[model samples]
Target: MREAFHEQLDGVFDDLAGICRSVETAVRLATQALLSGDAAIAEQVISADADIDKAKEKIEDTCFQLLSLQQPVAGDLRVVVSALRMVTELERMGDLSVHVAKIARLRVPDIAVPEEVRPTLARMGEVAEDMVCRVEQIITTKDVEAAIELGRADEIMDGLRRQSFAELFADEWAHGVEAAVDIALLGRYYERIADHAVSVANRVVYVVTGDFPVDV
Candidate 1:
């Protein structure tokens, strides 16, 4: 019975990891669509959201099955519960990507993102992607220390968000209000993506160390 329970738990982890990868891909594609003014790619990201939703549902169902059948105890219970919470965060991350894609579609002929902000957005995307990847590593390795470090990386994203906002709100770009709003929204989305990644890392920390990260 114990071995069977462990097998089910492993399956749950695999599902969660798959969801995370899908979300990460969506985010990357959305960022590219924004930068390139690719209406088609933006539409693709918007349409692909349903796929992420379905993956989340499957993960949730698997988690429920694990809990119902295994009745996990102590650390095992933590792993099961954390898987559910992690998938919730991953789903939100996927939604944020869709939000960015919507903005890309709205901009249409006149790209919503200004050239000045492109570099910052690219950097933000890189950091957000790295966070998602690292969270997956933490989940697979059960590395509490690595999870904590991933959480700390959120600070870099926060700083970038603030800088981006400052530039957007500055007097020089006053004429581009609509574009500025889009850029600001995009920055917030990327920052929140990192935030959610940190949340997943926290869950991994709890699952492995049996304690929630101190600063979550």
Candidate 2:
């Protein structure tokens, strides 16, 4: 019975890692769609979001089953509870990617990001992608230190978000209010994605050490 329980737990982690990879792909493609004005790609990201939601639902049900049948305690309990929380953050990260894609779709045939701000937003996308990738590693390895470092990557995302806002508010801005709003919203979406990644990493720390890092 114990062996079977461990196998099920392993399966849960595998599914969570798979979901993270899917989200990473979604954000990367969403950025491409936003920059290249590819509404079709944006549509793909939007459609893929339903799968992310379904993945989260499936994992949550597994967790409930484990709690009810196995009655995990101590470190095992931490892992199960943390997974429940981590999946919530991962689902939100997926939603943020969908939000980015939706903006791309809304401005079909015309890029939502102005040329001057494209580089900043592009960097934001790269950071978000990298963070999610690291999140997968932390989840699988349960590296508490690596999880803490993920917080620093989130700081870079925050800086890039500020740069995006500065460009929007700059006096030289030629883009009208509508464009400005899109840029602002895009920056927030990317920043929130990074924030969710950090949240998941911190939860990983809690799973490993029984306490979340004070700083992460």
Model 2 lDDT per residue over 75-164, tens place: 888888888988988999999999999999999889999899999999999999999999999888989899999989988998998888
Candidate 1 matches the true fold with a TM-score of 0.95
Off by over 4 Å in 1: none
lDDT tens string, model 1, 40-68? 99999999999999999998998898899
Using all chains and alpha carbons, the TM-scores for the candidates as numbered come to: 0.95, 0.97
Question: On a 0 to 100 scale, what is the lDDT of residue 126 in model 1?
Answer: 88
Error (Å) of candidate 1 at residue 64 is 1.1
lDDT of all predictions: 0.86, 0.92
Question: Which pairs clash in the backbone of model 1?
Answer: none
lDDT of 2 at 83: 86
Model 2 clash pairs? none
The alpha-carbon RMSD values of the candidates against the true structure, listed in the order shown, are 1.3, 1.1
Q: What is the lDDT of residue 58 in candidate 2?
A: 98
